[model samples]
Target chain A: MSAPIIGLVDYGAGNAASVRRLISKLGYRSRLVNKHEDFEFVTVLFVPGVGAFPSAMEALTKMNLVKPILDFANSGKPVVGVCLGMQLLADSSEEMGLTKGLGLIPGEVKALSSMEWHIGWNTLDCVGECSIASKSDGQNFYYNHSYEFQAPKEYIVGVVEAENPIVSIVRKHNIFGMQFHPEISQISGFKLMRRLLEEFTDA
Target chain B: MLKKRLTGAVTIRNGMVVQSFGYNRYLPIGKPKVVIENLDRWGIDEIFIQVIDRSAKSLEPDIELIDEIATSGILTPIMYAGGIQNEAQAAQVIRAGAERVCIDTLLHINPDEVEKIAKRLGGQAIVGSLPVGIDNNGIIYWYNYQTKEKRLLNDRLLSLVKDGLISEILLIDWQNEGFDEAFDFRILELFEKYNLPLILFGGLTSEKTLKKAFDAPMVVAAAIGNRLNYSEHAVQTLKNQLTSAPIRTAYYHDRSIFKHYD
Candidate 1:
């Protein structure tokens, strides 16, 4: 019954401090993991990212974190990706001309076809009983992204209708992806993170 | 359906929150953290904080204030404006917990720098802020805050939009910035052709006026500042009244579920 030690992956493309701050606010301990060795002692891994796909992939490769993240996701422990971090979980991205991702999940990231980017608060339309969606069912979360995950329909757990239905949340066993920034999504966002730590991690 | 946004804007001056009137007269409204906390609790779609005095004096963004707001654990996505001259400053603001940065003075003076910032941060993170005013002859011009100068809104600036320098446009009506008047509909006409997401701000006080702005096809968000400070749960009240509009309902109506973290 010990508190989980969360490893916040800092690949230089995200606001790791903000995610760490949110973890602290939720009454948990988290450390910024910049190297593969930093993931050794943590029970859960949270990859937080913003900005472009190729740059994020480059940062992870530069820090030698690509193997470690894939290893962690395969270990049957919980690994959560947020925003561009979520997009990075895919096989490849068309953000800046077909950049290869970590390939943890069976999917690819592509540009949203809509003329307007989905930026602001949108309601989470939960389609399954995933722990993150169960806590955040029908609640609004903040989103600011121009690309979305195109995964197989079975892995898709949650979606938001903006111009068209884009994957907002996805889960395949221990690997989870949230296209929205739960840290900045207000109370509902915090609740979803709390559920992920308290329920999903334990399960 | 894509919901229209109801944003609560906090204008900061001299490190204290102020009630800005046409960017001239100001009334202090306590600490910004308190205002931001209330806005989050009220379930506002987003929070826009613009530090008015920083750009004129050439000071850095109020990192201390931004840190305070971020640490305060306000959950709404934050957009910070003012004193953002280059990519580093924009990145700093984002690291300080702002989801987006609005560039007003920099957009006109050094557009190339804006392009650099856009490249560093994604185009979605950059917002083109044009404080505009119309003349008697019905021409749109950029209204400069410090120099009181007016520059025509021409193709050079419009080219920035085409070049993907900024993803969103924050159109400010300089003439009616601090008063309770109707939004300048003419300004909407000028930028409608671009088809960019527009956030309209200026003199939007009443629910009727807000509805009118939201009714516009191009306006994605309506930002209100002074009016929200005077009342409790102003955002919730406004959303409650404008139920038929595209604005999202306030989720805080059931306050039992939300935890007030100290």
Candidate 2:
């Protein structure tokens, strides 16, 4: 049997390397797919980000990866969006103006409009069923962002707060998104990533 | 009511995690993954993986070990240091799963390298690791391990800060390792003039010292490699003590939020 290949979208964001490191740490080979051609070999797709939403989305689209990425997500393969990447899944973002996203999840990315960057370590409030987030609440995950998903209640699988309420994790069947950096969050982060790998790969 | 954060340290040697202090006194700590996982389980906020081995000869970061720690499922952020002489290595460490990179010898070798890494990776990810030595006359000198040179600590710190090369500074007391003495607060007083976050290391023996350091406005966090490794349940006990404070009530409630994500 061959090891599952996880594709991390490299849209020139700062965290692609960290995400790749996390994926490699999980005993899997992760490729940094910045070009659209690499999409064919990806068993699972991970769109990871750590900076501004509009710029990230623009860069992804500019790289001409939006269609192939959305196609991959719709193909029923496990697709994940982390932090800024999660914010990129929403239909629209009020981050800079009214920037568009992949619209894979029913929501919008808005400035924490109310909360500060919610930096440092905080626990997750897992609410619904998820292959990665299930049975894992009260687990601290690192968050460093000034924006979050205004995701619908139905898709919100987890949450973390600081100064104001914000969504921490979300999903829609095979599609998943996390507002925290599980890579840096330590064990909890690793557990979530591992669960995702197992669920997606069924290993 | 502000609640402070818990910090942990991992000393790496020759790409392997080693326990050492007081200058050249080394002990094998096995794997960095196990050490990091142990600290992560204890609920540390941030971890510092100091690469003492990288400083021995050529400055090359141990990227593989850093990647290993990232994959181990530890829940703390890691700050990797040692052998980071330039921007490429610093970026590699960040790409290898280090949340921050600390530069010591490079601050003296190529001051521009420090600023370059900070500018690219963000200042928060770049830290200055200064080894302070108290000579026979009680005069403190900053030792550059790469160049094997010692200069007055203040001058070195001022020069680094002036160049915008360092946003955070880790002050290590080289002579007091395992001596059970407290950090040299008098030496750190000089850092107060600069607007940098000072992290004190070397002789952090007890919670009392931690409390003292916490009270100081200049000190953001304290590093205790010897005391933590020596004391049983020291990590858990300290965290329990910290989380037990009234200030952490709301933060504890925040932990409840993990349920939604689970």
Candidate 3:
């Protein structure tokens, strides 16, 4: 009956504090860890980000969190990457260059060339089969990034069909990723996060 | 693919939501907690809360309210702006649970302060909340509400960019305050060359205005307020009407499943 420990990996980008606060609001205990050692008792691993892909990966590497994150993803312990953290989950990004990612999913993070940084409250165009996100029913979630995930339809659970469509939700086993930041997206974000937390505990 | 951005703005006067016409005419809305909770309900992207009265004279961050929002399970990133004139204040606010700090009047008073804060919290964490107004002559100017004075907007914007002060700029058109005339793209014409991430606020009455605003590359976002509160199905109406995909979608993956972030 101990409180679930949500491991929030802070790789020096913004967005961690908000994620931490959101989890706290959900009546759960969360900690921001830059090392894998902190994952000992962690039930869920949340990676929050707010910058470029290469820089995020670089920070994770510098902090030596890359392997721990990769291992967590492989462990099926329910890991989620938000915003740039989501981008970092892909295999590579064409942003600054063809930089490598965590490769959790078979995809690439490409720049939003046709459009500017689509920064706004847009609907989560739910598409594929997802336990939590698929029920969104055109719910508008918050977003703030300029890169798009190229995850194939099989891996994508939803699409945030805004000015430009992008993979809004991706899942592989227990690993989950969100291109839009639910932590900062308000009640919709909070509700979704809570649902994921419930799923984590239920599973 | 096209991307879009969502910005939910909450005006604070003494730590509570206040309504102001354009950039002036303050009207008490309610507690910041309630408004934030409501915004959270709507699934807003990012929340921008600006303090109308805080300045160099006032250093308090309505810490109690901010603390409340930080812990209230409102997971959205709250961008706090007010009385931030130094790096200490900026750092304090962020550490107190603000994801970003929007700067204005003071940032111009001591441009270095913006640089100092941005350096500590990364340029992305610092945003220029410029309150702009245009005269009959069509000259854009930055309005100083405290002194009731006006200065050329281009110069201020140039100075901020040249000095590496802010990574993004939130433009609030004083002239467009409550009229809902749609965002004036002409105001954005001058900054097209600069190409910094710009968010347009004020006069966003209809989704039609938003569609037009989204056409510009530099105009990354447009925030809606009163109209949302007045509408019945505001969330769905706007979502259905705002056909253009925002910039945030491009990089976001699973925007569906709710997350837990304590």
TM-score top scorer: 1
lDDT of 3 by residue, A23-120 (tens): 77777888887776897878999888775677777788888998988887777788888887887888999876789999998898886655544555
Model 2, B49-76: lDDT tens digits are: 8877676767578887887776554446
Docking class of 2: incorrect
- In model 3, the runs with Cα more than 4 Å from the true position are A1-3, A11-13, A24-27, A94-100, A152-154, A162-164, B1-9, B15-30, B35-47, B58-64, B75-77, B85-100, B106-127, B146-149, B155-169, B175-262
TM-score of each: 0.96, 0.71, 0.73
Give the better candidate number (2 or 3) by DockQ.
3
lDDT of each: 0.84, 0.72, 0.73
Using Cα atoms, each model's DockQ against the true complex is: 0.63, 0.19, 0.25
TM-score of 1: 0.96
lDDT of 2 by residue, A112-196 (tens): 6563335556668877777679767877777766677898799999876555667899899988998888877655776778788
Interface RMSD to the true structure, each candidate: 1.7, 5.6, 5.4
Candidate maximizing DockQ: 1
Worst ten-residue run, lDDT, model 3 chain B?
B247-256
Model 1, runs deviating above 4 Å: B253-262
Tens digits of per-residue lDDT for model 1 on A25-140? Answer: 87778888888788887888988998888888888898899999988888888888999989988999998799999888889999897644787777889877885686677888
